[model samples]
Target: MEDLAIARACAEFADDKKAENIRILDLRGLSPVIDYFVLCSATSAPQLRAVRDNIEDEMKEKHGQRPLYKDGNYESQWLIIDYGNVMVHVLTPEKREYYALEELWGDAPEVALKSDEPAPEPKPRAKKVAAKKPAAKKAATKRATKKKAD
Candidate 1:
């Protein structure tokens, strides 16, 4: 699979494990080494492990691809999976905020993930009912207005 496809697949795997703030950054022309970066956040250690393992397993099974190197355990609150052209970073919310990878690589354009499912239909809007003025009040206001005009 191509680098972008692999990155998107990794993102999908992370999403399956409920990873938050998942992002795929296209670094083709901006970066010298990497073509893409898949960034995601997991809430806890177990979730971090799940995100990492899911991506690894799915990539291997579906695409016959494996990370060339894996770094950092779940305890560290940050994990890196290095494929040749793409790098996946699974981090905790705190670590992700601290590192600020998106801001660091600000020049790299983000790749929008296309969902296979169709867009959800919008909910019908509730009809608004206009409040009516009392007949007595309306007549009083009309008389006051007529007096002012005279």
Candidate 2:
């Protein structure tokens, strides 16, 4: 139960950091060793490092979860974080394409993770006008002059 939660949390955290092609695979019935797999792709080395750091921070802070067996450096194209039953794979686009984890683990059912991020609301645009707005000071000066004449 805790492992599953961690997997979901890791997936969300990766997404929050703009990780692409996020996936959660269920290996509960298929594999005796592992239960879940959270896979995501990063576009660049910096993004890969960011995703890894954010996931580690979130897991440690939120659930008191730590990686039991972590492999691959941030500089590498692929990194794996293992937490007993839940394994997270952070990879570059090239690595992901080469490995094709989704295709390899074709039997593992995909798990859905609900993102905490809300859809961005559209910002209100300024109404367009054919002409520039009248100067407030100019209008005030005109009003003052008219009042003085009266």
Q: Which predicted model would earn the best lDDT?
A: 1
Candidate 1's C-alpha runs over 4 A off are 115-150
- Model 1 scores worst on lDDT over the 10 consecutive residues at 117-126
Candidate 2 residue 145 Cα shift, in angstroms, is 99
lDDT (Cα) of model 1: 0.87
Candidate 1, TM-score vs. the true structure? 0.75
TM-score of each: 0.75, 0.73
lDDT of 1 by residue, 1-150 (tens): 767778888999999999999998877666667888999999999999999999999999999998999999878999999999899999999999999999998977778765453223322434567989789998999999999999
Over 4 Å off, model 2: 115-150
Writing each residue's lDDT as its tens digit, candidate 2 over 1-150 gives 466678889998999899999988877766667878999999988899899889999989988888898899867799999989899999999999998989987977777675353222322433555987679978999999999999
